[model samples]
Target: MTWDLLLSGGDADIAISGGRIAAIGPGLPRDAREIADVSGCLVTPGLIDLHTHVGPGYWGIDPDPIAWCSGVTTWVDAGSAGAYTVAGLRRVAETAAVRVHALLNISAVGLAGRTGESRDLANCDVALAIDAVQANRDLFHGIKVRIDAETVGANGVEPLRRGLEAAQACGVPVMVHIGTAPPSLDEVLDLLRPGDLMTHCASGIAAPLGPSVRAAAERGVLLDLGHGSGGFAFDVLERQLDAGLLPTTVSTDLHARSLHGPVFDLPTTMAKLLAVGVPLDGVVEAVTTHPARALGLSCGLAVGAPADIAVFDVRKEPFTVVDAHRQTRVSPIRLVNRATYVAGRLLPPRLPAPPAPWIPLTGAQRSALDHRTRAIRDLLTTPLVGVDGLAEQFPRRSK
Candidate 1:
């Protein structure tokens, strides 16, 4: 059968039909309606970000503009919605071009504000969270709870316990955000189950390097590099690497606050792993197969799998990357995306909306954003070509 699309001249040619991979080999039949030449590019399964904020709330940011350029096809909104507001997030998932999944917040209020969703114990209703997960199994893959001092003031691990209860009831994992001490990091680590995820594992603030952290890792708890504004630190990651504990998944906790810097996108976050001595293949797996496995989502670039793919121009050169602490390191290679496809369809280009009023921007960043906006306006307003460039479909006959 003639394929719907064919990606040729890459590491391996891939033919797509009916939103699934028809075939993948050295040379595919050129019988497709459309073909994209991806010469010298690395073709792989679409990257899945295990942690992010892309629902309607205080932290949400449109994902399309970033996805098209970054080769991330799946975005997991990490606790941006809860039982009361999941419907709104569902609308976002339905309308977005990329795949949008969510981890339901343990707090019924969700992230309607910057923090303190679980401050009031009443909001951490296990019954409500369980119902939300049960009702929206199509959208929610797990539960999320921020167990930091500010987020769970005086409540400590109570919110987490309630979250765990809901997660167990739904048979889904819980992804907990760790931050400053009130309950302390050990108390939070003790509660996570085998498949449960600890985002911001390499946090500078939470510095999870104690015996409790190691014991948790041994017991099958997964560590996630949720590189948000203050989540990742090169020193912490290096120490973890020295101790033989590496992140199971590499994800950008990309939101309004961290999007502009620190955690630009998943690709950049992956580069941070590479900077700290992680193998390139391992890094790729962290963003693709590993995260997919964590959430029980589909992944991989094989026949019969969904035709969710990404092509990147792998540049083998010295590239400097930074972590949350503004710590810089040089990477040996960089993956520049050339194309992104989801369900056998190419993702169209999308411009990002301006940052929210509350988001703080540096002077240089503001200036660059203004420059880009002006450039786009200039390009759109300008005529495509002079009159001579136009061809008349209907010539003035018998004039």
Candidate 2:
């Protein structure tokens, strides 16, 4: 099998021909047309970011090109669309560089506010949600039900109940936002089916998957690490991980704030788990195969699957990782994304350069300038203040 170009071993490779991966293997045949060696790099299936906000309006400005540069090839815009603005999101997602998907917001108005709109049943019309999902079935993967403190307000379980009903009609999973739920996590987990998803799992005082959370997983519900700016907490993650529980899918929950701070990118979030002693294979599975399985996506390196892969270099580099609280930690090792690919296209590269400090001035030159300034300013406070006399005495020494 000849190929137009071949990335021979490292992280992953996509054998592209008709805009899809024809094959993926450890090595391409020697007869391949063009071969690029990727020795000393790590390659795996292309990253699938299941949660993001790549909309058309204020939210659309996010999930930009850097996301690709950072190693994400496919992304899901989480609740960036509502009834009012889904058309705009659909318009842009059609032409975006990265492969984009969406979990439609339950609100007919879409994501117009930071606080969300699940608090009012009047704002959440099941008829409208079903109409939007039916109209844009191709672009929409599921429904987004936000249950935050402000969004749920006094509505309690009513909003989620409506959301679940709509989800049933749509015949797709519902992505529930986990924060302040009135009926408790147990009730929320019970409402969701095996295919339904829970985002923002590591959040607030509420635990993502506890006894019932695990029961939800046992029943086939997908647990997403949807770590956003203010949504992720180390304590919550620790509790779950310590309980020997892992998420079915790991996502960045990328938005405006997380992209710049402690959350970093998908690779960084994976690195956090790695720093905490997660085996390399387990971490890789959580992001790649596991996520794909949870999404009911076939992403193994099997023949005929799309040739999408994410290549990285797991090195012991000094990384200053920040958390949600603005705390910085000097980590000894981290997963650094080197490149990414979707189908058969080689994504833009992400090679980092060595760090070097700036040498502003020579020592001798600095000393001479310091002495001259001191001699001149020394006279400003003197009883006899003579600028000309000072200049004459100084003589402007030069090295």
Candidate 2 per-residue lDDT over residues 1-399, each given as its tens digit: 676556776545545554455656665555556566778877777777888877853344444455556677778888878877887888768776667778888877666656757766777898988888899877887888887667778777677787788889988888888876565878778888878888877665466756888788788888788877766666677778888767777788876545545565888878766655667788778777776665555465656667676677768787666555554445566777776667666665332211112213346545865675677668556768556656565576699
Candidate 2 residue 296 C-alpha distance from true site, Å: 3.2
> Model 1 over residues 54-123: C-alpha lDDT tens digits?
9998899999999998999999999999898988899999999999999999999999999999999999
lDDT of 1 at 340: 95
Give candidate 1's whole-model lDDT: 0.93
RMSD of candidates 1 onward, in order: 1.4, 13.3
**Model 2 poorest ten-residue lDDT run:** 350-359
Candidate lDDT values, in order? 0.93, 0.70
Judge candidate 2 at residue 146 and give its lDDT: 80
Query: Which portions of model 1 show Cα errors greater than 4 Å?
Result: 385-392
What lDDT does candidate 1 reach at residue 136? 90
